[model samples]
Target: MEEKEPAPGGLALIEALVNTLDVESGTDALDTEENRTRFGLTPADTPGARELREALRATLLAHAGHHPATGPRPPELGRLLTAAPLTITIAPDGGATLAPSPTAPGAPALTARVAAAITEALLAGVWHRLKCCEAETCHWAYYDRSPASRGRWCSMSVCGARAKMRTYRARTRPA
Candidate 1:
């Protein structure tokens, strides 16, 4: 797999959250205190964060024309995003942006942040460029920077190569 640049703006946050879990290794960064703090999550917030992560992963997978293969289906991302407590704030330059409500704590606050990021990405016309790798074992989130915006795997050197090798072996082996 090739090294990918981070997604721009708030989308980076969404990307980071979605990547917290290494699906193949079953290691979840959210299980660590430092990572939990990065997302404003507490020990009690881990379950909710995991739910949100999976939901985001599903959405990113859809962006790449793929479906999640395991785990109970998460709540619809739209429903979860709509429930976020976000308010619009207008700057002196007449630019308005979404901000999480002050009273939202922990997971809710993180949700609000994600909602705001999605909103920004949509307006920037780059939401669809953020996608999960098509490799089921490594559904890692990545920003699709290809000129055609159809990047399939997170890295051509890794997942892409593995998939090609598999197809080659299948073609050459005895029936």
Candidate 2:
């Protein structure tokens, strides 16, 4: 998200993409050619690409019972619904493989790629477990590995503790 190295595989990609979007500022790396290249996005970054990414992130956050502090909730537009669909082939041994069809290209194509990754994660039942850190300035992307899957902070030692301290001070300070 900070123009750093892309996170690892699986749901990490989605996190990486969402983190590229600044939560409080609504600034997005996908909106500019320079930033897009820094984030490994093609030079053909599309208009409204940031909106799509925001939609995706909002949907995931909503799944975790977190509403964005600002911005309108994305409408229920359903699956990305791209012209280039993922190609699914059943293997001879009863396996299946999904690949992207070579139809759409450029920015539209990139959107489809991100959408496909999300679709794959959704099918694996792990999409709901990925979330953005709740701290306004430190919205890091992280996987919720907590046993109960109720984890809200990216790290209890950092964001969680800071939040707790703030609450404690607010409650105890002299009025």
The residue-by-residue lDDT of candidate 2 on 13-98, one tens digit each, is 66767777765576766767776764445654545456566666667666667776665666442545454356777999998766
Q: Could you tell me how far off, in angstroms, the CA of residue 12 lies in candidate 2 after the best superposition?
A: 2.1
Model 2 CA deviation exceeding 4 Å by range: 1-8, 24-27, 31-35, 38-44, 75-79, 82-84
Angstrom error of the Cα, residue 31, model 1: value is 0.6
Model 1: clashing residue pairs?
Answer: 1-155, 1-157, 1-158, 2-155
Quantify all predictions' global Cα lDDT against the true fold: 0.91, 0.66
Tell me the lDDT of model 2 at 104: 58
lDDT of 1 by residue, 76-127 (tens): 8888887799999999999998989999999999999999999999999999
